[model samples]
Target: MAKRQLVPTVRLRRLALELRQLREQAGMSREQVADATGMNRATLYRIEVAQAKPQGRTFQALLEVYRVPEARRKELTAILKSAHQQGWLQNTDDLPSQYAALIGFEAEAMRMLNYESLFVPGLLQTENYARAAIAGSAPDMSAEDVESRVIARMERQARREPPQTLKVVLDEAVLRREVGGPTIMREQLRRLLDDSERPDMTVQVIPFSVGAHPGMTGSFVILQFADEDHEIVYLEASTTDLFLESKGDVYRYRRQFDRLCEQAATPEATRDLIASELSGLK
Candidate 1:
């Protein structure tokens, strides 16, 4: 069995599902796989459940048992290789485990759909706005802790990773909401306008006229991965967070996001809204 970790990564999650499907496709039970490979059934179970990392030798045996084609073998090997790397929150010990997982999801996602009703999305926040928001939302946090989180958020924005595509839906209230006072909010709105100009960034707004849209319940992020069939719906809270992976749950969130997008103003209209907010700011 390979070594175990506290949290299973996205690659590990996909590898587990793929391996299970491959085993099923081969019409071999775990016992049969264990018997054929001369490995323990417990080890096979652990590997399939992602309780343990699939070591090179272990996957080599698995590919042999399943008779995987060379091309598929290489793909699986790539996932295995990346599974050993650390999560994106390597330096932020102050970050909660669940929040770190959110960062991990963001780092690995091929595309992300985000909807925020209360404030600007973290990825698009200016430094001062982020600092103010964090400080306000987490009053229990020490000044140092707030600064650490602000730095972490800034680092996340700096990551020019595979999520070259991002679509954001914001409520009009977010534009009027005050964080870090007028100067900070003005800069943040300006940044949003600038970011929306990028070819891959799509920004839309749900005005007060929209009246109780699908995202009114709360904010969420839909993460779509190109490498596997795995999709994750992330719901964040003040303390703990939820990662919805079941097909039904993820499907509902995806549908909700689609509805939100439909109700949101166009990108051009959203820029006008931001400009209006900036003008109102001091």
Candidate 2:
């Protein structure tokens, strides 16, 4: 008999769903819950969506406010505690602190939609590419630091099954930018072509000809779980990361994705564009 694999996310996501359901059952808005527990709405939002790991006190306060029964509180708290312990990159602090939780989330995500307006998405980057990009950005990081980050990124790709769905929308400028110079950039684009051929992957290019598109604001990733929970939107900037799980905000992002898709070349055409770009690098 095969051993059961523990997916902490499954537990955390369940907790989140339960939390949200309880609030809904009580006919309370997020603001109402905030008023009840004296917790900020943003914090409550993250907790209910499993985007942030709530402290034990915070979870208890949340349960108190949501009126969760004593019978189920123990089980839910245990689940939350266990999920918080399943950190794969605990020893590797080389990666950005802001990215640690996101990396863990990526490991458990069933579907990931990534849009890169500047550089390649971390999940798809090769070791050399990862090293080059990291080193270039953080000149003070040690060689060992850069390598560990690369190893962590590579590990994300070694999945038993490819992500159930991967839609990567790359801006034309990302392809044109020489992050690691011509040779590395060419290989990177070729790798994109290779990865896109996988059954679970879809790659699209937002061509320069499109002029401007929905993703013009910035690069963001919208992750969908198989459990039909609220979608998560990850927005990044120069110094901060934002995780949005509000249904309204998620819907707005979904609309932006639709617009980006509309403006981008078709998947088949995207493959051709990537091929043409690869040839240009030769």
Candidate 3:
């Protein structure tokens, strides 16, 4: 029995995407390749979907069948090797598998553009605020599970070195909603102010006066990788998540974000807004 990859890394997904592309370029179907290599079609499908990591022999066989150049095959082999290496989140059990992938993506991103309409972005969330949000959203989760999730989120924020460039735009409603009551909300606002002071972080707010905006639909994050080709947009919902990688989807989101930047308050003004909200909490 082949071991399934419970947690697939971004590199692994990229490798899998390449393999699927290679097969298509060769004009071979999954059944054809499975028959030629004595691999199961289901296994091939799993590999392509990134649910299973391909073994070295499997990869070599596929490359040979595809007639890939020796140099290209070596480069792909290196990618496969790196993909097999587990990320920090691989061992975490409390987080949903989909959300865990988002953390992995966040870890590798060079910059992140986040737009929030209701709640604070997870990367910038304070501990108590996170606890409150998590608890409210998943009322059935055990106390231990909630704590584990909070710790995992904070760890994600802490793991970055030289800190990733984080630009966050929030709706005014996010500032006014008291997640964990007055005290916790005040602390959360203060934390936001402090975070904006960092050179690598930018915080902005879109006031109610702006009325309607492109982001009214919901919140999403665009993660930009060091390799521009790897950029993706992540959409989170109450029950499911979606990852968008096509150039068209990414471009649309990028343009929406630009429009958001235009509508949002400046960083200095955002800080003042947060401070005013904090004072009103008294």
Candidate 4:
């Protein structure tokens, strides 16, 4: 209804998958459904692929055509209604599509498993630390652009308002990288300590002693939703980011993260290590 979401949210995609499944279960081809609903085949395809949002009438028609159970119909109808609502970073034309897509995924993830080999977890970064990191990494960026990106990074922390369940496995190198120099790094470490204390957050660090582990490959995040059984693996890079929804891809990353977690220091030990790093920031 609202110009059809330019970038479909995870909720929308989930609904889209369900809609396609419902049609299949009902033994109706896209052609048949389009004919029965009197909707264009292309439009129906778009809805199934999550490129467009079906109007209420069209959604109702599809449900009727599929003979969806009363209970499931109400559930799906609720999802359809909410999928069209605007969400943060859902249409950020300024950012790379991959970056924006991660925002959508992160916002909806009820629980996140993040393994970082080079830097502090983005969502856990302090404002000053984030500014330094962004500005330093992209020296050619305009001041306004730098500030805008920093704001977006800060706003992403809202997901932790009720303290989102976040389990972080950070390499020892990230703490010693000195992104914003000593002062900023100290503040960043302190914030990580604070965040680690939160009931919903679990921050574990892989000390340098665990040399050559699986996470040394790079950073990745595994996102899980409350309403969905599947998981999404997100990987960010300098040139392009990736979203892997395939079961094999997801399973491999999940296994990697599991191993990384096993290699990390205990929460109590992590706090001690952070304290040691903070003390060394001379």
Total clashing pairs for each candidate: 0, 0, 0, 0
The C-alpha TM-scores of every prediction are: 0.70, 0.67, 0.70, 0.70
- Per-residue lDDT of model 4, residues 47-164, tens digit only: 9877787899999999999998998798788778788553322333325443545776676678999998888988999999999999998898899989988888887886555535
lDDT tens per residue, model 1, 117-168: 9989999999999999999988888999899888889988888454368999
Residues 148-192 of candidate 2 have per-residue lDDT tens digits of 878877877775266467888889998888888888898888888
For model 4, state the Cα shift of residue 25 in Å.
35
**Runs of candidate 1 exceeding 4 Å displacement:** 1-11, 14-95
lDDT measured at residue 233 in model 1 versus the true structure, 0 to 100: 77
Q: 57 in model 4: Cα distance from truth in Å? A: 10
Mark the 10 consecutive residues where model 1 has the least summed lDDT.
86-95
Best by lDDT: 3
Against the true structure, candidate 2 reaches a TM-score of: 0.67
**In model 1, how large is the Cα lDDT of residue 188?**
91
Lowest-sum lDDT 10-residue window in model 3: 86-95
lDDT of 3 by residue, 122-179 (tens): 8889999999999998899899989998999899889765558999999999999999
Please give the lDDT score at residue 277 for candidate 4. Answer: 93
